[model samples]
Target chain A: MARQTHTPSTGKLPGVEKCPTGIRGLDEITDGGLPRGRPTLVCGGAGSGKTLLAMEFIVRGIRDYGEPGVFVAFEETADELSRNVSSLGFDLDKLVRRRQLAVDHIRVERSEMEETGEYDLEGLFIRLGTMIDQIGAQRIAIDTVEVLFAGLLNEAILRAELRRLLRWLKDKGVTTIITGEQGEKTLTRHGLEEYVSDCVIFLDHRIVNQIATRRLRVVKYRGSSHGTNEYPTMIDQHGLSVLPISSLGLDYGASTEHVSSGVDRLDAMLGGGGYYRGSSILVSGTAGTGKTSLAAAFIDAACRRGERCLYLVLEEAPAQIIRNMASIGFDLGRWVDKGSLRFHGVRSTLYGLEQHLVTLHKLVSEFHPPTVAVDPITNLMVVGETAEVKSTLTRMIDFLKNQGITALFTSLTEGGGPAEQTEVGVSSLMDTWLLLRNVEMGAERNRLMFILKSRGMAHSNQVREFRLSDQGIQLRDVYVGPSAVLTGAARLVQEARDKAQAVSERESMARRRRELQQEQALTRAQFEALHLKTAALDEELHTLEAEDQTRRVTAAGEQAELARAQGADGNGGLSKKGAKRPADRYARA
Target chain B: MIAKHATSDTELLEEAARKAKHQKYVLRLYVAGMTPRSREALRTVSEICREELAGRCDLEVIDLYKQPTLAHREQIVAVPTLIKKLPLPLRRFIGSMVDKEKLLVGLDLIPRTP
Candidate 1:
C-alpha cells in the first residue's frame, strides 16, 4: 500500500491543477478531481442535473479560485437557465456583475431568417470566445449543443459545423463542460459527442424502495484515473455533494496521547491510567455483558478532557444509550450540548459499509474530533461482506492512527455468552484489547471489565467487578462472595435467592428470643406471690400478741368469775373462736 | 424544428441568381423516393436555398429513388442523405427530415462569434 501511494510527477502529467468537483468523494474517485484545463462533456436526461452541474462547476470556479467562467445555453434563455438553477444555489447574475461570469443564450429563429448557402458557425464561436477572454474564464459550460442540430435543417452542414465548434473550444484552452439532452437510443443526439470529449460523467436520479436516490457514475475519464462504483450523491440547496465512499485510506499519522476509560480502577489497570491516543481499542464481550458500558466509559473520559468526541452507534440510537446509561451516571446529552461530544446513530443495513466509512470519515475530517467511538463494529456485518468490513476497518484504523486521534471500537462476541470469537472479526487489528467476561467465584456471579492487552504499556489483567449505578460505573473490590459472572439475568435471579435466605434466618432468631422471655416471667410471678403470703402471716401474729397483752389483766378477774360460770356450763373446752394456727396442731393431737 | 415547405420555380431561379453573384456556396436537394416526405425535403431545400442561399448557392434538385441508377451512381445507401458536393471534403448527413435546426447546425451555416 505504501509503495502504491501517488508519487509526485508533475511534468509527466499533462494536466495537474485539479478541478474541485464540488462533490464529496468525487475528487477521490477522479484521482484528485477533473482535468484542470480540458473540456469534459456531461450528457443526461432533461432533469438529470446537467445544467445544475455545469452551473455549479462554473460558479465554484469563480467563487473559490477567482477564475471567471462563461455559460452559453443554446436551449433556454439566460434568465430561465439561471432561474431554473436558483434552487440549487447557482447565482450566475452576481458572478456576472463581478465580471467573473458571462451567460449567453443563443436564440435561433428560422422564420424570416436567411442563411447563405456557404456558411459556418464562426459567429457563435466568436461570441463565446470573446466572453471567455473577457471574463478570463478558467471554466466554460455550453448546454445542449443538440439545439444546434434542432435549429439547423441541413444535417450535413450541422455535423461539420459542430466538429469545427468543438475544435475551436479545445484550442481556446478553456476547461469546458458541454451538456446535451440524452436521447432514448444513444448517449447523444448525433451519438458522436463521446468521441469528441476528454471525460464523460453520468448522473442518475433513481427511486428505489420508494426512496429517491441520486447517484453519480463516471462512464469515462480520458487519460486519467477514476472510480467505477456507483457513488451516492445528494442534491440540495448546495447543489451536489458526492459521498466519498472510496477514501477509506484518508488518514495515517496518529498521536500517542493517553486518556483514561472513565473507570479509575480500569485506568489504573491500564498502566497508571489509560489507552494511548489514536490507538484502536477493541472491547469484546457477549450479550447482556457490559461491552457498550465500557466503551461509554472511554468516551465519557475523553469528553471529560474537553476533547471533542464522535460516537458512531451502529447498534443503538443516541436516545436509548443516553437513557440506559443514566443508571451508570453517564449523561452523553449534556456533553453533546457542551459541544464536546456528538453521537451519530446509523442503521447498519442502511448503506454499504464503504458509504458508512466515507460518511464517518467525512464527519471526523470536518469536525476534527480528537476521539472517536464506534459501538459494536461487528454490527456492520449485517450490511456488507466480512472481508470488506475488515478492510474498511483497517483503513479507518490506519486513518485514525495517522491523524493521532484516539479511537475505541466495540465488538460483540458470538452468542452463547461472551466467547473469544466475535461477529465483525476485527480483533487482531486493534492495538489494545479490553476483554470483559463473566467470572464466578464462590456463590456470587460477577461481570468484570479487564484489559487483556495494551500494546505499548503495562496493563493489569485483574478481573474487577464492574457495576453501573446512579453515580456511574463503579468497581467494588470488597465483594468476596462467589465470583460467578453476575452481569446477566441469571445472576440477578441467583442474587435474589441468596438475599431471601439471609432475611429468613434473621426472622426465626427473633421468634426464639420472644418465647424465652415469656417462661422466665411466669416463674418470677409465682415466687413473688409466696413471699407476700408469708409476710401477711407474720403481720397477723404481731397483732395477736398485742391483743393478748391488753386482755391479760382482764382475764385474771374474768377467770375467777368464769370458774363459777364454767362449773354451771359443765365441760367448757377451749373456745374454737380464740384458737390460732397452732390450734391445728392441738386439734391433730 | 419544423419541416421545410415546398419551393417555387421563381424562388429557385432567384436562388440561382444569388449563387452567381458572390463566392457563396451552391446547394442541391438530392433525394430518393416518391413519398410526400421526400417531395417535402426537395421542395423545402429549394425554398431555403432561394431565401437564405439565393444568388449565392446553386440549387440542384435530384430524385434518386425515382432514378435508382442515379442513387447508385451517387453511392447513396440510405434515403434522405443530404450531400455537400462542391466542398473540398464532401460530407453527407443521414436522418429523417424531422429536425430543421439540426440541419443548419450540421451545415455550418449558423453565424459564430469565435
Candidate 2:
C-alpha cells in the first residue's frame, strides 16, 4: 500500500540505475527493481515459480514499461509457454505478433546429438541476437538456461560458454534475467550464479504441515541496497506477486477524523463518537459473545456513510453472513447490492498464510475500499502456526494502515482462555480494543462488554450488558448487586425484590399513622368524661355552700332582733349580740 | 554351428546393404560463418556423403552469420550442427565432425554397436 512512485526512470539514486519489474511489491523491495542492463540470476527448485517470475518480468516490462523483450525458453516450447502463461492474462502470441516480445524455444536432445569435436555455442548467440534485433528488445529472460547442461556432454565447455554468454549479454547493455535450477550447495545447479553476478534472487516453495507457501529473497544485489528478508510470494491467475513484509514503514499519516461504530451507547462508551479514521480496531470475545455482530454493526455504519467496505469472512459464507446480520436489523445485503459493500468469503484451510495475505492484498487493491472488516481473524491459525499468523496479521494491519483505511477485526478467543488475550497476539497493534465476555449468573449466560483500551481517547471502563435484539445491538448498564455484577434474570429478580421491600415499608408506615390517630381519639374522649364529672361535683358543692350561707344569715338576724327588743341596757346587749353574730359569721366563712 | 553363424552374418549384411541403398539421407549443417570448425564439419560431411551415401544423400550447409534467423527457426544451439531431416527420425551432431564413425552412426548409414 506504500504507493511506489520511484520508477526506474525517476530513481533518485546516483550510481546504479534500475529496471522496474512492474511487479506489485517487487519494485518496492528492490528499491526500484533489478539492476539495470545487467544479468540477474533467478534460481529455484522445480515448481518454485521460477519460470513464472521470469515470464512475468518480461511480460510486465513490455506491457508496463514499453520495453521490448525476448524470452528464451529452454525447457518448454513457445506454444507450451504461451499456453501456460495465458491464465495470467498475458497474451504472449499477441505480444509476439506486435513485435513487442519474442519467444524462442531452444530444444536440445542429448540422444539425438553427437559431439565429435570442439564447438562453441555461437549458434545460440546468433539466435538470441537475431531475436533481440527482431523486436529491438531491451529486456531478455532465459528461463532455466541450465537445460543445456542436460543436453551437452561436456560440462567444461558448457560452463565456459555460459560464462561467455552472460558476458556477451552484459556487453549488449540489455537488462536480462537468467533462471537456473537450484543446486545442492551452490545457488544454481550449473553454478550460473558464478557468471551473472549483478543480482541474484532465490525463490523457495515450502510445504509445512501440508500448506504450501512460496517465498522470495534477494540473495545479493551488487552496488544496491535491497530487501534481505524472505518475502512471501504468490502466483495466481493474476501472475506472480511478492509481498514485501519489511518494506512497510511506520510512517503513514494519522488522521484525526472519526467514524461511527453504529451502536449509539457503545459509541458513547468510546468517549468521542467513534474511532479515529485509519485506525485499527479489535473486537475480541469468546464464542457466542457477539463479536461478529459488533463488527457487522461497524461495517453497517461505514456503509451507511456511503463509504465502500470489504468484509472478509473465513467461517461463514457471504449469504450466511448477510442472513445472520439481517436478523439484527442490519441490511448488509442492500449495501452489497449497491456496490458499497463487498463480501469475500474463503475457508482458512483453502490456502496457506501467505496465500491468504496475498489474496487480501489483491482484493483490497482491486476494490480500493475505505473500510475493511475481517470477521474472526483467529480462524487463520488453522493454516499457520501462531508466529506465522501473527506476522501475517502484522503485515495485513500495516498494509491497511498504509492505505489510510479504517479496519475492524474480530477475534474469537478460546472458551476458557482469558478473553483479554488474543491467540494471534495482534492486540498491541490495534488502536482500540473492545473485549466481550459471557457472565454466567442465575443459571443463564449473559453477554457483557467493556472497553479494554482506546488510545488517544477517554473511554469508559465500566462493563455493560450486551444484548442482540431484533432491532439491533444494545448496551445496557450492568446491575451491581451486593455481592456481584448482576445481569439477565438475576438483575430483574433483584430489582423486583427491592421494589417489594419499598412497598412493604410504605404500607407499615401508613398502618402506624392510623394507630396513632386512634390512640389520640381515645385520650380525648376520656378527658371529656372527666371534665363532665368535675362540673357535676362543682354544682353540688355550690348548693351546699348556699344552704350554709342561709343558716348563718338567719342566726345573725335573730340575734339582731333580740338586741332591739331589750330596754335600757338593751342597746349594749344588742350591740354585743351583733358583734358576736358577726364574729360567728366570720368564723364560719 | 559355425557355418550357421556365418550364413546369418551374411544375411544380416545383405539386409543392411538393402536398407542403405533405398534410404535417402537429408542433412543440414548449421555453422557460424566459415570458421575452421564450420569448414572442417562441411568437409567431413561431404566426404561421408560421397563415400557412404553416394547418390542418395542431400546435404545443405547454412552459415548462421548470413541467415541468423534460421538458428532460432531451426532451434539450433550449437555451431556446426548437422541435422538429418529425412531418416524417419531426425538426428543432430555438433562439432567439427572429425570422427566419421559417430557421424555415420548418427546419420543412420551404419548400424550402431550395442
Which candidate achieves the best TM-score against the true structure?
A: 2
Q: For model 1, how does the per-residue alpha-carbon lDDT over A403-483 read when each residue is reduced to its tens digit?
A: 677889888887675466556667777878877766555565567776777888888767666777788778755333575
Over all chains combined, what TM-score does candidate 2 have? 0.86
Interface RMSD (C-alpha) of each candidate? 16.1, 0.8
What is the lDDT of every predicted structure here? 0.69, 0.89
lDDT of 2 by residue, A1-589 (tens): 0012232434566646789999888888888998877889999999999899889899999999999999999999999999999989999999999999999889988888889998989999999999888888888999878889999988888889998998777767778899999989988887888887789999999887788999999999987898999899998888889998833568988998888998999889888689988999999998999999998999999999999999999999999989999999998999999999999999988888999899889999899999999988999998888899999999999999998999999999998888789989999999999999999988999999999999988899899999999899999988887787898888889889989999999999989998998898899899999999999999978886777677667866766676556534556655666657655675566
Q: Give the Å shift of residue B113 in candidate 2.
A: 3.8
The clash count of every prediction, one per candidate, is: 75, 0
- Quote the positional error of residue A265 for candidate 1 in Å: 2.0
- Model 1 lDDT vs. the true structure? 0.69
The C-alpha TM-scores of every prediction are 0.58, 0.86
